[model samples]
Target: MTSTVAAIFVGFKQLGIADETDQRAIYSRVTGKPRLSLMKPPEKDAVLAELRRLGFTTVPRRANGRQQLTGRAAKKVQALWIAGWNLGVFDSRDDAALIAFVKRQTGLDHASWLHQAGDTIAVVEALKAWITREAGVDWSPTGKRDAAYLGRYGYKIAWAQWRILHPGADRIARKGFDTFVVATTGTTGMWTEISDAEWQKVMNALGPQVRAARKAKP
Candidate 1:
């Protein structure tokens, strides 16, 4: 009955971080706040105290009023938190089963599945790109961004934009993701780079779209 936010975060491993980061980023985007943490319960409590000390709570009341939770007091957010257990609720010791549950729960057909399990919509939109092979207008010489670079959502988002603005998928692959990832191997056109700024922009802009998409799901 007692645990640290860090422990939960460890339990969540990587996917939890992505989900919470996306949620907090989306909240900041809509409200124009500076930034927020995606920390778990105990850590969140400490962070909440820090915010209180910083006097961020004194500003004009937001839609949800509690800036600490980032308007996430909705039943849906709470439900999302609870739904995470579908992956690990019963089998806590089995890490493989836990990870498997995570995949089953997220159901996002990602290239690498690097992110924490997120809202159902976020997962779906991510899958929409990873699972669907499409054509787009030429942006890169290849016509589509590399799957390895975009992870699940990033590749899909970039490709989707190309399909909308451009029409070919080949050009995207050539120009879109050549240097997107950072390469330890240092091969020609093998890695892609994702800058924090670009990710923040994408999270801010595409997040709402993904969230809306999740809301649209069954």
Candidate 2:
């Protein structure tokens, strides 16, 4: 097979789309070709673009010519680690447990650094979904509770203001605040489920810091 044809196959495999019938369906949709071997240059380009649109990141080759995960895929790996930590599935210091979790989830017996971009993305998404279902909190790419978990009120007012004051804060900061909310409110419930008074307590506790940060920004 030509390099382009090989790339197309690799792209599909990375997408975790292994069924020949399904692969042919996508191939037909992109190139109007019934078979990958029949694809022209333009068709190949189109199919590759479609794969990228579907969240496929081309794994970069190392100096030794081995394929390595991309930076974006690495972040997903980090997020998975944090999610595992937060869920109490493993302690923060347990690298072996994280590798084991990935092994169980993806059936891949290597560390994330050795994973292909597609494998990393697939595993991260699957793990995040599992964490959300188990913990009753939507997980973000940053490995913290998603802003949506705070619901309309908490997100719109409290989080909005927090972001305004701490515009440069990283995901770790956001995670810390999320941790505080869970601890203070004593539940992972959404804004509607939690009392207005409880929300007020969060605001009261953090409001001064927000104001001080705003003042200090200049």
Q: Which candidate is the best by lDDT?
A: 2
Instruction: Tell me the spans in candidate 2 whose CA falls farther than 4 Å from its real position.
Output: 1-72, 91-93, 111-115, 139-218
TM-scores of all predicted structures: 0.25, 0.32
Per-residue lDDT tens digits for candidate 2, residues 1-218, read 65456666777888899998998898889888978678777677677778767866556467776544433355556545554343333344244455566788778633323334566667767666665554333333332555433453333334544454556545445755667766778877454566655765665565556555545645
* Tens digit per residue, CA lDDT, model 1, 1-218: 22233322333343333576654553355444433344344344444333333332211234554321122222233222222222112322232332344367566322122222244356434323332333221223232644555454434444444333323546435454334322312345433555433433443343344344434548
| Candidate 2 RMSD to the correct structure | 14.9
Of candidate 2, the 10-residue stretch with the lowest lDDT total is 134-143
Q: What is the lDDT of residue 113 in candidate 2?
A: 31
* CA RMSD of each candidate after superposition: 17.9, 14.9
Clashing pairs in 2: none
Q: Give the Å shift of residue 169 in candidate 2.
A: 26
